[model samples]
Target: MTLLKAKSILSKDFRIGRASDRLFGSFVEHMGSVVYNGIYEPDHEAADEDGFRKDVLELVRELKLSVVRYPGGNFSSGYNWEDGVGPKERRPVKLDLAWRQVEPNSFGLDEFMRWTGKVGADAIMTVNLGTRGIDEARNLLEYCNFPGGSQYSDLRRSHGVRDPYKIKTWCLGNELDGEWQIARKTADEYGRLACETAKAMKWVDPDIELVAVGSSARHMPTFPEWDRTVLMHTYEHVEQLSLHHYIGKRENDTPTFLAMPLEMEQQIKDVIATCDYVQSVKRSSKRMKLSFDEWNVWREPDVPYTPWQTGCPYDWVKFHMEDALVFGSALLSILRHADRIDIACQSLLVNTIPMILTNKGGAAWRNPTFYPFLHASRYGRGEVLRLETESPKYDTKLYTDVAKVDSVAVWNEEKGELTVFAVNRSEESIAYELDIRDFGNVSFAEHLVMNHERLDAVNTADNQGEVRPRAGGTTTLNGGRAESVLPPYSWNVVRFNVQSA
Candidate 1:
């Protein structure tokens, strides 16, 4: 194997932008066991007075999630928010056509908001524009944000929430470009509805922000066009555009899978260009940012599961050690584009391709992909510093000019700390060096690395500690230069604290 070498230089003065706290967000949809047995299980031994799972809530807090998008992915397209508001005993068990599961309607608007409070995270509500329209969107906004003296606000009072939830961000719809969605529409169709709905929603609560739907994926036939058209119509009405993409692998191409971040980077760049072009065409003063509402590693089984049933448990995606590496790379991609993409959510939070997996009535465990997210959320706050990198390059079957090492640096000025998140994508162990500028009396804080002997090794509920991050030894800062050996296919976080020289 050829020796791989990589070097990166970062400075506190050269920064991308102040990282948005909302960038560390996750999603929760009413699909699979994500709702019923995942987060809220009254019968579970770990349940609290409010029936929310204490175990899951603790893990969620540990992840340091800033915001959570609620109620649906595809489920929102067909969801009737009204059906879920009343008492649980009276609430009917409705069939969720999106996932073919039965939504008990037991956990509705109030319950989710309550859970958000318990987890200490804000909410980003997504409205139904597929089966519903502007009227319903306006009503939901009024019910959630309006204080009193109105019918919807009074209805919220009747539902036991005297204070309004005051949700700030709202999604017009989810994945209108995909055929899998209910009442899917063309770009023009979704644009018109989204524009009209956004206007009416702002008419109800002008202070709130809106996210218009973009393409479901870059591979979609109408990706750039969809983004262009949607922005052309709703650019002046909305504050952000929504994008969703899930990385998956087949036939065991580990190198290709690890390099998937390149693809994500391209997609983000294309969308940014499209947004800018639209701004120039309309001569609009406002610039559109992105909300990556759904993203994760989804691997399909050799044989697809047959016979989907209501309330039946399903394990959609079980992540391995390699997936964590890719997950780290994905976060780095988002950090690189932190200037424009302000918000992101890592798909489902519980079961069915979740960061944390639960054992129904038993225990909850963090998957391999959880640690990278944890480290990013904890140390990756503050301003993102730009890095000048010199790394070995290679080519994969699908991706060319691939960097053997990928990395991002975040400088927390308030805490006087700097964090460098790096990934060694090459098959051979590489010597990595980082040079710091304009800093004084810096000391190496911690070097945390996530690596496994087997790339596909996983942690189960019984053996939850099997695949976890461990200390990757220590580093010494000599004149602001730190060096370490990045193991082959490893995710490393090197942290340093600054002091007076």
Candidate 2:
């Protein structure tokens, strides 16, 4: 066993930035059963009038998600938004080229907006820049945001939506640099398209913010170069650059997998450097932020992804307890970089290795990774406080000087609360000490820890509570200092209620 010692200091002066609720966003794609059987199941007994599963909606609401990116991941690149609007009865059934799943135009623009409203989350629409271009994007923007005068707006009225959806964020495209994407474009091609599309869409609705596509993954041969070239064309037109990363487990190494968030941190840094490089070249004052719109722990497909299968969808994998630790670490990494990363979406919200998983006509249960996100979305709000930790280090196969503890602090002034989220990456328990500075008297409100005897422990529909967070009582606060024994490979959240601080 390894003896790990660590200390954390929190001060209000050392703050990163205010946390955007958008950072707590999640994705809803048309792939697999994420749509048909995941969030929406018309015939499911628990479904609402809009065909959305009420139980799933309850969980989504519980997550307190701020923004939901609608209509696609890769699916958006090949999607036709017009097909899913108007009357569901007359809606045409087509094939989704990206996911190879049957596209039953039943749930489209109007349905998604309604669902988003019901869940109290903002909607971020993605335009198809792959198969379609600026014209289609502008038309869709007009349809969704215009107020009943133009052709597209009037068409929206004819579809029974009198008021504009007034969506504020739009994604110009998705993963244009990846060869697997339909009509994948070169950096120059995508950047030009994104720039023009953003200009036209803003012309229709100036209130909106646009995100230009960055490299699909950090390892893409063109990674930081792809970001730089895209930013060269879209620097002024877009507000954020979109990034997608799916951390996978290979070689069955827990320590290496736990250190994956380090890679994500480096990816964000590389993208930031690329963005600044373009800003320097253009001599522009504008600085680009990031939208990590698709992120989660997923494995590469066991089988080659088959195309053109109308009814077939991507396979779903059950995330184990170890996956939850990694997911929590990733969220911690995003929070630590809160200044630059304003928007992040956990890839597919349900049914496809997501936070929530459901069986057709059976049950929708929270996966092992769900609780960590739930805690973050609920308590991980307000300003991000820079936390410095001194701890024993270990080297992984991929990452060196890996700290035994990865943590972040959030100070919610209105709530008079300071929440500390920490993950123990070591194989032995860490007796951690926490010290507070530049703050008034506070009391330890609660300590919640999620740990299991076996890192491979998993939760199923019937055994959904198998791996969940429970109250941790060992942490004690004396004066302004606190001490606790962080369990081996655990995600721990310690909250302090400020008393007139």
The digit string of per-residue lDDT tens for model 1 on 349-389 reads 88777898887789998988889999999998988988899
- Evaluate residue 339 in candidate 2 and report its C-alpha lDDT on the 0 to 100 scale: 92
- In model 1, the Cα lDDT at residue 285 comes to 92
Report residue 109 deviation for candidate 2 (angstroms).
1.0
Cα lDDT for residue 346, candidate 2: 91
lDDT of each: 0.87, 0.88
lDDT: worst 10-residue window of model 2: 302-311
| Model 2 / residue 486 / CA error / Å | 0.7
Among the numbered candidates, top lDDT falls to: 2
